[model samples]
Target: MRTAAPYASDPSRVRGRLFAEDESAFRSPFQRDRDRIIHASAFRRLKHKTQVFVEHEGDSFRTRLTHTIEVAQVARTIAGVLGLNGELTEAVALAHDLGHTPFGHTGEDALEALMQPYGGFDHNAQALKIVTSLERHYAEWDGLNLTWECLEGIAKHNGPVTGALPFALAEYSARHDLELHTHASAEAQVAALSDDIAYNNHDLHDGLRAGLFSDDDICVLPIVGAAYEQVDRLYPGLEAKRRRHEALRRVFGVMVEDVIDTSRGLLEGLGSVEEVRGLGAPCVQFSPALWGDLKVIRKFLFTQMYRAPSVVEMRKQVTAVVEGLFPLYMERPDLLPTEWAKDVDAATTDIARARLVADYIAGMTDRFALAQAEVLL
Candidate 1:
């Protein structure tokens, strides 16, 4: 194991869970958190959730679960290199997308729009709900009862929360403050950046595989073209598959190395995790040059992949599915599973009922959602 950097999140000194339990004899607290996340029903549901492509669209396209695993792998790599807490990073990465609605951002957008009157839907906030209250597998607790460090990482991974907070997050923080006004620990920052790296790299690969764009087309982008040129120079007659993999791996390497080198310098003078949070900015990030290049690549992807004609059409279809389902559930809470009856009965206000309806709908998988639409809407 790498010796932790001075500023790394130290699991030994971690803030305890809301519902206290004896520390595991065999596992670090963060390791136990990672295990709990892996075993969560929300994690399994990720397999059938969509990103750019719907679940049944194709076998080769990335599902939410696969994308999450890739994020965890990248997070672990970056966290390991930075001497941060790898287990906590991996837990955050694995749990980051837990609240994403089925059918990718399309579904989330539709849900958000439909939910506008009821304090809006933010995936980050919903993820907080899932961990702190939604999942109910334990005999002693309703949720995973993760440590404050993991919860803080999840809540503030993107950065300091400001303005009006989402309802779910605000509701939780009312009971146990996540310190929403400050940056999360360095491990969480690594997890957040890893999310960016994973999506950008794999979105390109999936776009190519989906026939939305070609390797030739991507080579027109900044870092991609240089990578392709390097691959060609190294192996003049390399086959297309091998060549593409080599080039993209180079692209991936450039990002990882840039983040490590850039962050190492930023973390140089920090002496503790509190200093990491109080620095008033992220310590982990891509270099400015690489970030600019990534922006160009992201724009290309926005047009050629995420907003391609076929994808847009699918988006419309999924949007309708979410739109149709939310109102139906609101009109008919009895349609919610028997398991949800207690909460449904307890929810007295319109806002509470709307949020409850949204919760059930958000927890759905792509196929299950479509099936519900087919049957009810």
Candidate 2:
């Protein structure tokens, strides 16, 4: 591997895991963290979790697992160009969405609404919970016991948390301070932007495939229209599918190159990871012009795909599933799975029992949640 940049996260200087264990003989800490994430039960569940379309809706739509893989690919490329630790970036990207509920944002919104009287739900906080206190695999600890940098990156990758943190995040922060008010490592920032690149581009592709929008519609948009123009100039009368793929690939290239160029210019004088954290803003980002263009693209997507009639209908169905399940499990704790039933029974307060219910529901895959709803509700 290439030497990491001076401002990149250094494994040797790691803050160590929440529960100490012997280092691996063959793997670096970040690599081990990546492997642990890949092997986790939650990671495996992502295969059936929602990205946009419900997992059962179509075979071709991007599920959470595929989206995570795409994000990791983009993140590793950015990290390599910046001479940062690819493994750390990959770990953060891979583990970032492990906390998303059954149906995508729809399920999360429903759960958050139900839990509003409780501490409420945040996927980022739920992700931290999965890595820190859930995922009971190790005899020595509860969660994955990941390195502190990995945890910090996972918690603050979108930048510092200044306002009131969600319950799970506040609970973990009380135990180990993640320095919630500062930026994470540059690699984390790369992973965060990589997420942006993957979702924006892939959503456009998926939206087209789902027949929510058409090529003619997207061909008038800013970055996307330019890509189509370039593709037509190069390959006149190309097959429609091939033409779309080639054009979008160019769009993806533009985003990746913009991030590398923009971040390279930003990191010139940065000498240490601490300096990276203290910069008060992300060092890795698209150029101002590209960012503005991306906003236009996002607005287009919000209207054309995310809020399309078909998608909105599915969202309502899934929201009902989550909303229906939460109360059933809450009022009848015995309805929970065997292991979860034990926790529900032992809970001393309504909030404690509600949190346990959230954990059970949040861990469910789309089909499983639907099946449970069919039987229980």
Candidate 3:
């Protein structure tokens, strides 16, 4: 089905014209955003990045690429059901994690520390940089100069009003001064919520596979476990894949329904719907109700998955590896990859040096980082 009229404006500022190359074909603005993201180089790098474990650890676990694809799937379904822009949702979902470092959160933490003085490391903002100014593949420009909508989706991929500080900044003073942050557009808000849904639901599945947690342990969670039980009762003796898929679908259906029902009220009542429409483009977000749900889920993930002992243990090693490498690389700039040498010498201060260090580290995959650390060790 054709996507709804874009909830946001075309980035090009051309009124009444589609973002597509030719409007005669009737392509939607969000579709154009999705296509551009798919063709970008950053999207492909996800395959090598960690989701839970290193990608090569096992065939069953989700890699960053798989996780991204799954988020897109869930986001698209939610968008379609809610009369939102599926294309824009898909675009945001696909690109949301592109700036994530190679080893997943571990890499992010390391970069955050290393870049602490420069500005700080924020994966979402970095993803924006990748598409807009960092990716070298676009010879004609510094970056893709994607639509404001796409940029918003990526920036707020965690959804609007996260009540969280900006993940990073361009300079340390911005952070130290506790500066007020600008909000990301609504489209990014949807992507952010979708990301939460994808990880919370799917990580349970991945956690089971990695021996980090058991299905029985997972089943104890509030609604999710109950949802799993309902699926088992409904489909007795079904094939494993069938059962798991059915279970996932059921859970997703619940979450999506909750988001739609919740968001519609906020959009209609809280004035965001009219508010966003007035912005001149297509974007979507968590209704007030969904935002409440987000807090609940965040608590659960923190208590259950994120703080799990296994994950914590692995984090230590990751912190050590990345932290150890930073000073070494900085002291002997010669240790950096050839591409970074120019940036190294040109850097006028420690923050710039840290960013260069992070650039080198962020570009590495899980194994490459380990390998490099070993050489330094």
Cα-based TM-score, every candidate: 0.98, 0.99, 0.81
lDDT of 2: 0.93
lDDT per residue (tens digit) for residues 1-377 in model 3? 65443343333342321122443256665676678788877777777788867666687888888899988887777766655666666888899888888778877887787776667888876776677656676445555645556665576554432344533423322322211233444455566777878887777677666766555665665556767788889888878767767776676677777776765554443333336634443244444555565566567666666777877877788778888887888888888767687789789988767777776777677777888888986
C-alpha RMSD (angstroms) for model 3: 5.0
By the lDDT metric, which is better: model 1 or model 3?
1
Candidate 1, residues 200-238, lDDT tens digits: the string is 999999999899989889999999999999999999999
lDDT, candidate 2, 1-377, per-residue tens:
58878998888789888778999888999999999999999999999999999999999999999999999999999999899999999999999999999999999999999999999999999999999988998888899999989999899867898899999999999999999999999988999999999999999999999999999999988889999999999999999999999999999999999999999999989999999999988899899999999999999999999999999999989888998889889989887778899999999999999999999999999999999989987
Better by TM-score, candidate 3 or 2 = 2
Q: Is candidate 1 or candidate 2 better by TM-score?
A: 2
Give the Cα lDDT of each candidate. 0.92, 0.93, 0.67
For model 3, what is the C-alpha lDDT against the true structure?
Answer: 0.67
- For model 3 the local lDDT of residue 92 reads 83
